[model samples]
Target chain A: MTDPKRPRDPDPLADDAFDAALGARLRAGREDTATLSAAVLSRLAQDPRQTPPGRWLTPAPMAAGFAGLMTVAGVAGYLWVPLFGAGGEDAILAAALGGLVPGGF
Target chain B: MTAEARAKGASEAMDALMRGDRLALSRLIALYGPGIRAFAAHQLGDASEAEDIAQEVFLRVWSEARRYDPARGAVSTWIWRIAANLCTDRRRRRAVRRFLGLEAVPEAALPDDAMPGAERIVAGREQMRQLGPALAALPDRQREALLMRTAGELATAEIAAAMGLSPGAVEQLLVRARAGLRRTMGEKDDD
Candidate 1:
């Protein structure tokens, strides 16, 4: 834990006078407030916030959705290939030849 | 007005803004423009770019107002966070530009002659000339923490929230920034 009061580094401008002087100097160089405000307001008026409700459907979500779809397809293929052979040709023939077996009575 | 009252007013304004009230946005800019501009100018060391960044920050607020949750923090904190992020983006873009040799590195603009008084203006300009290099020498986060603390008059907790750091971390950044400035200024004074 760092001590709040510890003088880790000596600050020559630790006094209030230096703080005030620095603040004033920075403020003096500041851009005109009214001008900046007007520019901001004008820009805001020109390009009003038109964020759509579906803005959250960004690329990440889209990519995730695609991956999920691919995973489901892959899982279905894996199950199907094992249950019905690589092309399911034998299963198709068996279903079509139902009751036409050579030894059927 | 008390801090509570000011915050209440800001909350109301934000609510109005979320409800598509342009007047609320104008009011927000009126209230927070100077501080935002100062933060940008100090961080970027360029007045024109600061103005551009300030404009971008408010535009973002207008767009993102509905996402704001007052329970999380004040409107000022939200706004400063946007300003800081935009300034960082601009700095990164400027770096890329300079790396590609497409643009020269920008120097902080000297104080304009249109400043009201002559004598005081000259002295302030000299002070800023000294202060600019000292400020530019500090690391980005340290410079940012110090400027937001001092120029923006933001509380430590508010700054921490804006910078996504703990209050203690923000204080340490401030300390280091001040120490770095003092050393740089001392070196300048010696030469």
Candidate 2:
């Protein structure tokens, strides 16, 4: 696999030796998966929680959609306020502020 | 089993798994589990993490079967690409934990209290013990490339496709990885 013309090429023999050594070490470290296999297979069989850990929410798309919705809602609310009379504006402000106070709005 | 036979078995298992056959999923796990585990173990320096990866890989294979395109690559290649991606995510999370001081640096290998000093000095065992830290010391990409090559038993082209790199780039990575490992191991880099 080594080409002398290629600057990336090191000594071919040494590379092979390194690979062999690494491969051996990896093989030795290989996990015995009988118990894991059983657990995983049973989980698949029972259809326990399809999503992997920490991936259940899929936050990006949801967060983007939420932000878009909030922006549009804010813009729409701002635009609609001008059409409302001063009384309506006061009513809206009171309605919004009421929720911030203690007890039911 | 021959590579041909193994590939054939994995393909059949994948097909069955897509049909919702749990037994076929088990077979697929049996086929690729060791490699995925070894790949993860070497990458994360932890067996428990490796087990998590192996289990997750199978679950992913079960769920994402429809997304698989046989024309793109072999079954092993597809499975390994998933494993490689999971390993990347895991390593990143591990790094973040370390950065936040939420994690302490754990020993790379479990201490074998049963093995006496003389027995621990055996050449292969000693070399294997040394490798954990040496591998951990490697830069992420270099370590990943080497682990995928060695532990995943992936061809360079398969690795390239998995890593979204050209075959030439994969070759360069492999060469650099080997050189890095050599340097870490106190071997002659010129050699």
Q: What is the DockQ of each candidate?
A: 0.25, 0.36
Candidate by candidate, in order, the iRMS in Å equals: 3.5, 3.6
Task: Pick the lDDT winner.
Answer: 1
Candidate 2 clashes: the total is 0
Alpha-carbon RMSD to native, per candidate: 9.4, 6.0
Chain A TM per candidate, in order of listing: 0.36, 0.47
Model 2 spans with C-alpha error above 4 angstroms: A1-14, A29-31, A57-86, A90-105, B109-125, B187-191
| Steric collisions counted per model | 0, 0
lDDT of 2 by residue, B101-186 (tens): 99987667432232346555365456657777778888777777788778766778878877788999888888877767767777
Q: Write the per-residue lDDT of candidate 2 for residues A59-97, one digit (tens) a residue.
A: 465698799999999999988888977977998889989
lDDT of each: 0.76, 0.76
Candidate 1 lDDT by residue in tens digits, B1-191? 44466567778899999998878877787666766776787787887788778777877888888889988999989998988877887777677778999987677745556588889788877887888878988999998988887666677899999999999999889878877998999999999
Best by DockQ: 2
TM-scores for all predictions: 0.73, 0.76
Q: Candidate 1 chain A: minimum summed lDDT over ten consecutive residues — where? A: A50-59
